[model samples]
Target: MEKKCVNEKKCGSCKYLHMTYKEQLKKKEEFVKHELEKCPELKGHFKPIIGMENPWNYRNKVTAVFDRDRKGNPISGVYQEGTHRVIPVEKCLIEDELADKIIGTIRGMLRSFKIKVYDEDTGYGLLRYVLVRRGFATGEVMVVLVTASPIFPSKRNFTNALLKAHPEITTVVQNVNNRTDSLILGDKQQILYGKGYIEDILCGCRFRISPASFYQINPVQTEKLYSKAVELAGLSGKETVIDAYCGIGTIGLIASKHAKNVISVELNPDAVRDAIVNAKVNGIKNVRFYKADAGRFLTQMAEEGAKADVLLMDPPRNGSSEEFLRSAALLGPGKIVYISCNPVSLGRDLGVLKKLGYRAEECWMVDMFPWTAHVETAVLLVRKP
Candidate 1:
């Protein structure tokens, strides 16, 4: 069965969508294998890649960039593959269906309002982007209207009109980005309607997700990936756990049941706040969230002679920095479960950890983003005696 996306060439987001899903998994497995081969020490520890049962419409979030169509009418869609050119995405196979619908509805509303979209060349406009995020399990929705400026004409009428059109929308926020740069959202934000946040259930825990919160786009695969990481950690209800680069404390809070305590470190304060609220919502008392640099926090822990039995790190796609790996070595966790988005970065970081008395013992690849050339993996590392 072919996927539902039509703009494959114009919107090159789905690079591997041409092949069958099985073939996609095979190719991804080979890619991870080749990346791991760069690190000869853990070359043989690669396990069979975990795939999704049904990969369609998995993303909980979607964003539409504002651009003018050839007809000079304001349009919104994704950027073309490897180009700044806007390729209007009417639908996406990977994004949640409701999110796509809401985005379309917003675009229609913008057109109806005659709202001038920010032109990158002219720099005079109101809306820059429309970001729609839906709670996969909660049925809640949040719409972030990214504008070039905070001053929105007829704001109240526009809000009323949008809410009237889409009664399912739970919240609406306006993010102002006055700069000409390509950044989607600015630091200044105002809640135009509702509570300005949404909640979702992941791994049997409730999480509060804001516009800035780093919740996983693919919630279903994220549960599988995090579960694999927790299982790899081998938590025994007696060991302390440390979650480095823990975004909103998803991994750490989920692992709280199996561990005596979990200390999650994040650089984003907004995420840390959400993590704390999520902990309270889940009734998870054993976990604590700290807003600090993960590397610096780990370094401080090492200096204080503090140690954790289990360390779980889910770094960004660029991968872990050498300072983070160095801090991890100094922390000296008995077991380290690394959840990585990029295999090449994982390979590079593993080479660094190998010199620090840590070796990869088990590895599992989870197909988080199907149809895309992205792969997520969890690896268990044990300190050499």
Candidate 2:
């Protein structure tokens, strides 16, 4: 099929926009297969999961950086690749309609308040970016205003104006990002209106997400991914399961129905607290959350003769670290479900597991991030005698 870039050379989000969806999927599948081939032991077991039909407009949330135009009017959108030039986005195809509306409202609010755009050189600006997250099931919305400093009186008035304007918003948070160079949230957060956090339901469990917490951006695909992970774990009523990197304990909570005991390990204390609250609200006592580094906890467990029948991992985009993978392999769980967003790193880590005498029993590909070059994969590895 012929391929063309919609916003060719303008939008930096998709470098492969010039390629057709079919061609993009094909390229991604080939890339995954080749990476797996790097480990001869995984050559026969590697499988390609099918890509999604509608890849565009799949993202549930979008974080748009703010800048000012030549006229000194605030421009709200993403920056051009490798440069700080602001690209005003009238309609982002990747986000939902609510996200677009939130962006439009924020732009209007900035204009109405005459807010100054933060300059990278001077490091002065009231507004930095607007983040919007939508709940698929409840139609609830959360608007997060990221700024270089605390909201001024005028900006606070602007936030009040927004809440009065849009009642759909369930949570409005102002994140203070004073650091000169960083993409993360600042040391403090002030709740401007309503609840400080929003609720998202996954696999029949409700999870409260703060601005800094990490949750899946794509709700529909995440549900499918979590369901698949639970299935691959093959949870039995008598089995003990360990969910590593259990962000908010979504996987562990879902798997609790089938497993007798679930131990969820997360490095972030805030996430761990949220996980515990989620478990309590859901009337689930079988799940326990530990606020510790995943790799270190697994290594300690291995040294202490602690073992789990099933081990489930949903690591970050970089995939699991070498130490974590080696520790997991040494634990010698009956089954290991490794979920990853980056195929290259997943393949690399799978090679390490192969040397530890584990074989990839099954592989599934999920088009979690469609339209772009990213894909989510899940592999179930079993220890071989």
Candidate 3:
């Protein structure tokens, strides 16, 4: 296998744009294992992390900007690194079949309407970017059309045209981003068509996703990730588990049946509301949702004498803050299940936990982001007696 970079030096999305899929997976595995060795307690427990068999076309969502080529043809795709010039990607090897089809369809429609693509230089044009998200379990598609202006009469007509043409699109949201900056999403959103949200089923738990809410992009591998996390938690129906940074309460909802009680903490109010709705939809009553930061919630729980036999932490890519890590270490549950998308940060946090008298008993990796360098990991750490 040879190294392959789709746009070579043009696109910065893929840092390892020059490496083959196999080489990338191998390098990632070695990287995780070597980092684990830095934690003396985790040295022997670290195993060869699993890799995805099909390492291409696995992305469920793609955000592509709109631009124009030298020939004046409307080009809808991502931008080249360090330049506003768009990388005219007719087909992305990392996205699913539906994503590719939708991109092609939208590109043709934009060309037909002669819709002026967003120009970063002059800050003119209506169309800014297209966000496409697909449900892996239900095969539902949500298309969010972001524009620099309101839904003009012509753009509304275009939106109607898309709905009339494609029935697979379950939700169509028009997001207005009138700012001159490069922020893709705005606070204002209006449902243009179909249901306002999409549903995703994981471990028999259904989750509702909004345009701004964060859900696992890879559904198949996310099941594997959550399953591994549950296994590491060692739920026995008698333990209370705290799922920290629990986005939409998927982990807590799924693990509720195995644990006596599940407390889910999330910062986003929308996500918390969605988590409550999901719990009701799934008929889960053992889970509780808290609209608060995970670290603050944990500190409050400690103050209130709320004890948990097991704790699950799934922080964002930036990993847990030092204060959060310190609070988690102070709580010192019997078992800790750490799920991380960034192995480097995972290793660093695991070092903190090890110093707090917790030892890594098991570690596994899930190839959540295929065809990309990102990997998800699950680790079980036990309090040393």
Candidate 4:
């Protein structure tokens, strides 16, 4: 029998914790195959879903909401499913063990430091949320303190105490989120200690990770997922590739080693800056990054008769926009490799691509989130002659 999590029902993050690993993989495979079947042309193309050898404690990133219990004591955990109530979780099977311990230490230190946990009702207190990111390969850790305001009382002392407890922490950042919304990160940020960012190795390349970058949460499976995506591209050292929606240039930098040249584009300035630094750090010169809307940039390139041999896109969970799909078709890449987290949105976008003369050739699933319903998918589409 699987050992059930104490807060499994309340936390509601992992729906398959009770099932065996094999059962979880089978369920996910069936779920993804069913989703792809919605587009008949995409049927019979799904390869075996890749699963992790050790799925527990695979999440390198952890975010917890701050609250006070009836006794007015500080606590930290995730929000309950479909509700704003924070369910305190001391340890999570899917989260990094060190991150959990670090969060526990921070939670305990808040009371002694006279720091008040934020109350959403009256909008009072200092700390709002705590986000921790750990590099599985490098053993580097980052802690982001989400506060309601910039004025942090005894900020130095609090940081010193936290560091004293966990010297493994590489950096500490203060993110001021004064809004009433549910977003964990705010616009304003100041580095409280060390360098503001941490580095991690992915697919034999080092990537600079900032707090807001859209990096994969599970690094172990990420290597496999990206390796499959690159394999599907069939790069022969002569292909010109375009990586759209490129966050910190993870895929582009990885693909650059094989392709002749890679063009990567993203809208976020912070991400673009980090991507440039990442390229420099990795000493990769063949890939170039642009801070522009991917769809618009590709459309302009297509209008200029610029051509690419392959197009790689890893859009958000909502999937790529129709504009981006149309522009992708306009660019007329011989092959398209799409990495999607949401199967429904992927099906919808696949149908759009089908009408644009692209046919789904093969699809592979990577179980990045082991216990959760969410699964990462990579699909290869070829332009029909």
Put down candidate 4 lDDT per residue, 68-116, tens digits, no spaces.
Answer: 9888888899988889888888999889999999999999999889999
Q: What C-alpha RMSD separates each model from the true structure?
A: 1.3, 2.2, 2.2, 1.1
- Whichever of 1 and 4 has more TM-score, that candidate is 4
Cα deviation at 18, candidate 2, in Å, is 3.5
Give the Å shift of residue 250 in candidate 3: 1.5
lDDT (tens digit, per residue) of candidate 1 on 37-94 = 7556666788888888998999888989988888977777898877788888777888
Residue range with the least summed lDDT across 10 consecutive positions in model 4 = 37-46
Clashing pairs in 1: none
Model 3 TM-score is: 0.93
Q: Could you give candidate 3's per-residue lDDT for residues 160-265 as a string of tens digits?
A: 7787777788988888888877788887878888787888898888889877777887777888889889987878899888899988889898899899999899
Q: Give candidate 1 regions above 4 Å deviation.
A: 39-44
Point to the candidate with the largest TM-score. Answer: 4
Q: What TM-score fits each model? A: 0.97, 0.93, 0.93, 0.98
